[model samples]
Target: MKHTIAEVKISYHPNRLKGAVKITSSEYAGKVIRENWNQGTLNLYEEFKILLMNNSNEVLGLAPLSRGGMTGTLVDMRILFATVIKSGATSIITVHNHPSGKLKPSQADINIYNKIKDAAKLLDINYLDNLIITEDGKFSFMDEGY
Candidate 1:
C-alpha cells in the first residue's frame, strides 16, 4: 500500500488594503490596525494580528493570528513567518490588543518580539514595529527604539 502526504497550502486573495493606506508612521499603522479589531471582543480578549506590507509600505493584507483571554495571546513564530512568506510581504508590523488598557509590554512581550525580529532577519524580511494597544492608546516598540 502507498500513502501520500498532504502538501502545505497557502492562500491569499486580492483583498489588498486601500493603496492609500501607507504605514508611514507607527501612529498611522496603529490606527489602521485598530480599525481591523473585533470591537465586541477587543475589551474582552487579547488578539494578535499582522500588518503585512509590500516594498512600498503598501498594506498587502491583515492576517489575524490568535486570540486569548484578558491577559495575553499566543503567537506561533513558525506560523507567523509562513504567513509573511506566503503573503509575499517584504515587511510586517505586529499588533496586539491589551484588554487591561495598559500599554506597557511585559518581559514576555519583549522577549517574543526579539525572537520574531531575529527570525525575520534570518529570513531577510523586515520586522518593523510591534504595537501594544488599548482602545484609547498604544505603545510602539519602534517608537521607543526597541
Candidate 2:
C-alpha cells in the first residue's frame, strides 16, 4: 500500500531551529529562507528577527516567529519585542518568504512592515529592512523598495 499525498503527515521541528545564529547578507538571508521551505504544495512562510550589533554589522541571533501559510503567519509585537530585548539587540532586520515564488510585497505586507517599524521605534530597536524571498531565487522589497 502506498500513502497518497493527502495521507502524508508533516510536522515542523521547531527545536531544529534552536541556538539562533546570525544573518549577514541577502545571500545569507536567502539561504535561511530556503531552509524553511516545505516540500509540500503549500507554501511555507516564516517570520525571522535578525539581531545586529549596535556598533558593527555583526549578527547576534536569528529568531523564528511563526511558520505556516502565506496569510496564516501571525507576527505578535510582544513576542518580537521580547526576543529583541532578551537578545540585547539594538537593531534588527525582518524577513519573510512568499511561497508563490514571487518577491513582491503585497499591501498587507507593507502594512505589517509599517506596524513593525512603528513598534520598533518605540523600543528604540531599529527596523532595518523587511525582506521577501521567492522559491525562484529572487528577492524583493529590501532590494527594490516596495
| TM-scores vs. true structure, each candidate | 0.91, 0.66
Residue 137 local lDDT, model 1: 88
Task: Itemize residue pairs with steric clashes in candidate 1.
Answer: none
lDDT tens per residue, model 2, 44-132: 54444444444343556467777766554678878887777766678787777677776667787789888988898988886777777
Give the top-scoring candidate (TM-score).
Answer: 1
Model 1 poorest ten-residue lDDT run: 12-21
Give each model's whole-structure lDDT.
Answer: 0.89, 0.65
Candidate 1's residue-wise lDDT over 3-23, tens digit each? 999998768665654545788
Tell me the lDDT of candidate 2. Answer: 0.65
TM-score of 2: 0.66
Candidate 1 accuracy as lDDT: 0.89
Off by over 4 Å in 2: 1-42, 45-54, 138-142
